[model samples]
Structure formats: C-alpha cells, structure tokens
Target: MTRKIWVFDTTLRDGEQVPGAKLNLYEKLEVAQQLKKLQVDIIEAGFPASSAGDFDAVKEIATKVGNTSDLMITALARAVKSDIDAVYNSVKYAEKPLIHIVLGTSDIHVEKKFGKSKSQILNIGVEAVKYAKTLLPDVQYSTEDASRSEFEYLWATIEAVVKAGATMINVPDTVGFAEPEEFGERIFKLNDRLKNLNDKVLLSVHCHNDLGMATANTLAAIKNGADKVECTINGIGERAGNAALEEVVMAINTRSSIYNVHTNIKTKEIMNTSRLVSSLMGLDVQVNKAITGENAFAHSSGIHQDGLLKSRDAYEIISPVEVGLDDMELVLTARSGRHAVKNALEKLGFHQITNSQFEGIFEAFLELADAKKEVYNHDLYVIVENYYAKQDVHNENMTYYSDHFYELMDLQVISNINFPSASVKMKRGDQILKSSAVGSGPIDALYSAITEISELDIKLIEYNISSVSRGKEALGKVKIQVEYRGEKYIAKATETDIMKASALAYINAINSIVVDQLLPVE
Candidate 1:
C-alpha cells in the first residue's frame, strides 16, 4: 500500500521571509483561503510572536478559514514559553490548532547563535514541547539545521522531543547543503534506530532551495521514512526559498510508481494558487519554471509540436487542465514547420486559406519569428487578420485600424552622480499628459514618470532585456511583466536603444492592461 504524505504549507511564515514580499492582513486572508482550497493538511499561518499584525492575521485565518476547512492551523514559535503562548493565543480558536516550536541544535548554531551546549539545546527542545503540549494537543518540534548536526546528538534530540509529547518531529535541511542520498540515509537511519518513536510519531522534512536540491532531498526523505513535507507556495522563502509545495505534490502524484506515496492536494487548484501567490507577492514565476510557469505546457519545437498534435502523451507527461490551466499552447516560432503553422492558424480561427495566402503568411511569420523570440496567439491573429484586411482593401472595402488606447509621445532622461530625473509625454485619446519625476536611476525615474502620467497603480514584477541579434548596434528586446489590480500583464518591444525598448515595453504593458479591461467578457 502507498503511504499518505501530509503537506504542511508555511507560505505565510517562511515564504514571507523573502525580502520585499510582505503580505498585509487582507492579503494573508486571501492566500489562506486559497491554501484551504488547495486542501493542504496543515497551514502554518504565521509567526504570531513576530508582530501584532502577524498575530491578528493568524487569528483571523484560524477563525475564518481554519475552523471551517477541517484542516489544522499552526503557527511558528521558538522554544520559549512566551513564543509558545503567543502561538497558542493566535490559533486557539481553530477546530484543529497546532503549535510548532523550533530550536537550533547544530554545533555552529548552538555555540555561536545560541551560545548553548548540545545538552542545553536538547533540554530546551524537550521542555518546549512539553509546555506546548499543555496548550495544544498537536505539537511539532523542529531542530534547526539538523542536516549538519551530529547524527547521534540529533537522534538523541528527536527521542527527547518525542518522549516529551511532541507528536511530530521535523528534521530540516535548513541551509539546503545536504545531497539527496545523504539526506535519505539520515532519515532511514533515524527510523531504523528509533523504531518505537518513529512508529508512534510523524517524521517531517523541511528543505531549502539554496542548492536547488530541496525537492530532490525532500523526495529522498519521503522515500526513506518521512511522513510529512514542510513547503511553501512557489518556493518563496528565506535565501533561495523553501521546497515548492506544488512541485513536491505533483512529483509524488506523477511518479507514484517510484515513491509509492500520495498527498491530499487538490491538484486542479495548483495553477490558480500559484497565480494568486505570485500576484499578491508582486513576484513573477519564471517562464521555464516547472509545474505552474507560463511556458510549462507551451510547446515550440517542431518535433515536439508534431508529436503533441498526434497525441498529448507523446510530449506531455501531465495534462495542463489537471493543474487548472485551460490548455496547452503550441507557440509558433522559427523552429515551427508548415503543419505547426497551419495548426496555430486554425486555432486562431483562420481555417480557410489559399496556397498563395498560406505562402505569404508563412513568409511573414518567418520574418516576425526572426525578430521576436516567440510568436503569441495574438500576434498570429494580427497577422492573419491583417492579411484578410489587405485583401478587403484590394476589393475596395473600408477598413479601420484599431487605435492604441495609450501611446508614448516623448521621453527625456537625465542621469548623473547626484539625482536622476526623467520626463515623459503620453497620449490617451485626445488628451496629452506630461509628467516628470526623480528616482535613484534612469529606468526608475522613467518608470516613475510614466506611472505619474498614466495614473495606473502597477507593480513591476519582472524586467528582462536581451539582444535580438549580435552586434554593436544589436536590436535590444525588452520584456516587462507588471501587476495591476491582482492581474499580471506582459509586453515586449524591440529597438536599437535599450532605454527606448524599456520605455516602450512598460507603456505597452500598461496599454495591454487597459485593453483587457475594455474587452467584453464572453
């Protein structure tokens, strides 16, 4: 029989530790609702003792979501009475409330950070669990940086915590410094040596992504003996971040033959949850990121597209719809052949085309592909629509070109050793708006000026620039992703001047947002 793997999501606590990724009370509540929808076994709402705001958030989540969701609500605390009491106060209203207490057990942490000996650390952990058990029935104890600690001492600490009434013990790869084999061996050895305690209590693993091996290390632990995984949404956390909850859950779901384990995650909610987290945090998921990225299910290669068109399983291991995505995307590129082009055109509702028209469109597609990295559905629609529009004009029919809702008129930037300033002129319909602002850098000033002129409260989630062709005067392509009113919009532009490309890209993204708002819902 396969083992049941519990998912404990710490997005509100550990994930929030990422710099500049703080969530306010309403945002916290929003994320907690999504986590509930995701069906995680436990939600580590926040560190209540950290601040009054966190305490209120935790309390609110516990009362609003946790009590009704039938899932456990937990909060982080150090191995201290005050911290444990704070957590207790925050989560006490939940139907199932848990107190999670952590202590540093590694030699470096013990001697340097805590200035305590091994025995002292062990005593504190045991006492903290015992005290926590008095307040909550479910108590979880974590030994910080357990991967680097002495094995024997770590086993002794686990035994002590379990004996002191800790129902769960989390052995974390705190610094993400352990390899999979070694981490697996550590868990296997602990379970082998402490059979009585291991059989009675749950063994959990929390891994960081500093080494980009958190998911691998976590899989090793689960394969060995771990019963729970401590993770965060989109892997957002301190340093490089924690192991991603979606990745781990999907890994187990997709590779059940190997791991022989399953999770309680509602797989269909994965993408929605990821988007919600990314939007609220003002972070952009990388295009090539696994599982929930923009390009995760996008096929661009000719051979891959051919195989996918024949059968989805020929190229995709998991269906996009399984993760809440609408469908797979066959992105048209220079690498795409005639069949791929026809397929894309059909998807864009351009099914009928003469051979000559097909040749012309394919030629134009090649030119566009040479200029851009990838051609989107919108670009293909524009190409086909323009072709028919030209035909209509040749037949002496009237045609109207759609005007841009927002257009950039002029931009002037001044940068020096002191303060940098920028001025921008924008045209919206019959109105010409002008604004100027000062910033720490030229791009910042320019963006500030644009925002001031447009009056759109947007957050720049991602900015990337690359050369379309290699030369001294290479055509620079700028891609910008921005978030407005909880929605993400991406736009790209190319120009000889990098700054010009950047300004155009920013304004184009703003225009795309406006267009989306103006579009009629189907």
Candidate 2:
C-alpha cells in the first residue's frame, strides 16, 4: 500500500533566520510559487510579526499565490495575542489559510522563559489555539521543544491543544537529539498511550539538523505514522538546518516498499528549487551535498565510467536524468580513448565540426594532451579559434585603429591611427609627422600617444582579451570598442604579447569605424 505524506515548507519562516540569508518580498513570492508547484501541502510563509517586510510578504503570498483545494498558505505566530493578530491579518485573504501558533512547553522554557507553571503553559496553548480558531478554522499548534519535554506532560498538553481546536499538532525535535529507533518509539508510544490520538487532529513532525539526523528522524516519525514532514529547500535554516525536501522525498521514493509513502512533489523541480534558493541566498551548494549537488551523479575512474557506459545500473543506483543531473562525463585525460575525445567534443556544443577543422584542432589537442595530461574546454576553444583567424587584413574591408604604451605619471599615450592596413604613414605637407610614444602599460602608452597623433579624439568604451591559439605559445587576441566623435568603433587582433594585442585591438576598433564610413565630429 502506498502511504501519503504531506510536505510542509518553512523556507520563509525558519530559513529566513539564517544570518544574511533574508529574501525580499518578491524573492519570497517567487520561492512560494515554486513550492506550490512542488505540491507542498502547506507553506509557512513567514513570521508575520517579525518585521513589516515579513508581514507584507506573508500577506502577499497568502493573497496572490495560494489555492484552496491543492495548497494552503500559513503564517507563524508566537502564543501572544499581538503575534496572532498579525498572523491572522496576513492570511485573511488566503483561499486556504492556516494559523500556526507555537508556545514553550518544556520545563526549562516554562520556568526561565515564560515564567509560568506547566498548567499555565497548557492553558496558554489551549487559549492561543482557541483564539486562532476564531480567526481561521484551520489552526496548527506546536510545542516549541516537544522532543525534550517530559512524555506525560507533553501528552497532556497535546490533548489540551487538540481539545481547544488545533486541527494539527506539530511535534518538533527541538534540539535534534533523538536517534531513529528512540524517536520512532516515542511517536509510536504517543499514538498508543494518548487518548483521541487520531480522532482529534493530524500529527506532524518538525525535525532540525543539529545532530545531522533530521532526515533520519523524520523518516522514523513517518515510519511510526507522522502525517506531515516540515522542511526547507536545500535544508537551509537556523542551525545545521531542517530536513532537505529533496533528500527525504527521494529517500521515500527509493525505498517506497519499506516506508510505503508518496508525496505530491513533482521530483523534477527539485533541482530548479535548489538552484533558485542557492542563487537568491548567494550560498553555493557543495558539489557533493546530496541529490541536487553537481557531482551527486558524477562517476570517475576507468572501471566506473566503463561500467556506467555499458549500463547505468551497473554502478548507479539512481539515474542522473531522474534528478535533472547531466549524464556521466568522459573527460579527456592521458588514459582517455579516442571515443572519449569524440564524446567530449560532442558535449561541448560542437556536434557538427567539419572534418578538416577537426583534424587541425585535433593535432593541437594531441600536443596539449602531452603536456597537461587533461584537456579542458578553454584549451579546445583556443585551438578552434587559431584555425579560423585570417592573417592579412590587406584584401578585407578595414575601419578603425589606435595604439597604446606606458607613460610618465602613470598616464597612457596612444598614437598611429590607420585604416586599410595599406595606408601606414600619414603626411602633413612637408612636415611628415610619424605617430609613436610610450606609456605606463603598453596599451595605455600606445593609446595616449595615439590620441596625440591621430587628430581623432576617441574615448574607449570597452576592451577584452583572450587567447586565439593553444598552449603558452598561443596568440593573444584583443578587442577594443571606442567612441570617437559620437561614433563607435570595434577593433580586434591576434598577437604574440599583450602589447601587440592592445595595438591590434585598437586598430581593429578604428578599422570598424572606417569600414562603416563614420567620421569624427568637427
């Protein structure tokens, strides 16, 4: 029998507690929609009372994104009336609104924190849930530290909240202490010992990642009959984090026979959600983190790759494509075969290179293959470019040009503007002035002198450099774009050194301008 699990996403509520990981309102809404598509049953959008921004985000998500039949939007609140009011206000427009009211339940929290007796805390939990029910029919109640609370006290409190109108009860392993067996036993006992256990409300588990056992504990909870699992994208939260939605879902999927569980998650959107969160949070997911990591499905070594090529199941328990990961890479190392090289080139977006071009590029590749013992994409790009560059500009249409070299006071001197490559030197009557100079850097010096000599004042807008050939002996290519007399010119060149690269680049820019028949302002 396939069991069903409800996914509760708390990315906005708890994930925001991560320092410097706050998402703006628009970003929050974007993620919330993604979660809805992921088919999360409930989304704890935010702690509405925390800030005006948080309040607005919760309200907006609740109003704009949530749908009634398939999804529910929720706002978190402390047991305080003001917090409850804020939460209620935020979710008022939600088609399926849920108010989550949480209060301290452990002995330590009751004494030092709220300074209330156990009975008083119970009363507060009941009253809070009751008040939340008045605002919204669906209310979720959480005992802040249920895992650490005494079992008898926790059971009595759970009974009180359910009686007081909490539609769901969230039991959290606050400190992430319980191991799988013990936690499963605890939940199993809760159902066995507690009265009206299944009749009153749904039972959910919220596990943390403090001991690196959140996913395990959550599974244990489900093994013992937890109806919902609370999690976040990438497992991001206050401490080590919550159970990753991807990990738990895939686990249940892979071991469905044992857990007998299924969730509404699309499974494919796991990668997209992981990437969006990583991008917004500016936190790089480790290459081997888990299901969505870059190298999660990567296999290296001759034996493994060969086995994978033959049949993925030979070495892989899960297909990379199933989780949106690209298939195995046949990187060109010293030990790589010809088939590997062909495969690599194909994967490089060059599926249809001419045989002549491939032959020329391959010869250089063999030379590079002898040195580094591995061929990267950059090395291949350079090899291909060298085969394509035209040497002489005599027959071709030419436009703009300039020169640069270093000068005193860290200034740049540019000179020797030319076009058509055939018109080398210019004459001013019998004066016959030649353009040349030196500057700080070769380009700077060349540009400064060129400015003095060209009689065409130009302001450089952009410049770029790259290698056009393979190995250290490869030629450097420079591209310069400049604005002269309200006209833009682009220059490019292949050269041995950067100084030559700069000269050619400027010349290329001037060539573009001249080719276009552009003239400087008078």
Candidate 2 residue-wise lDDT, 184-243, digit = tens: 988887756443555547788898989999999999999998888999888888888888
Q: Once superposed on the true structure, which residue ranges of model 1 sit more than 4 Å away at CA? A: 372-522
Tell me the TM-score of model 1. 0.79
Q: List model 1 lDDT by residue over 14-66, tens digit each.
A: 99888888999999999999999999999999999999999999999999988
What is the Å distance of residue 217 in model 2 from its true position? 0.9
Q: Please give the range of 10 consecutive residues that has the lowest summed lDDT in model 1.
A: 395-404
lDDT of 2: 0.74
Could you tell me the lDDT of residue 126 within candidate 1?
88
Highest TM-score against the true fold, candidate = 1
lDDT, residue 55, candidate 1: 98
For residue 454, model 1's alpha carbon misses the true position, in angstroms, by 17
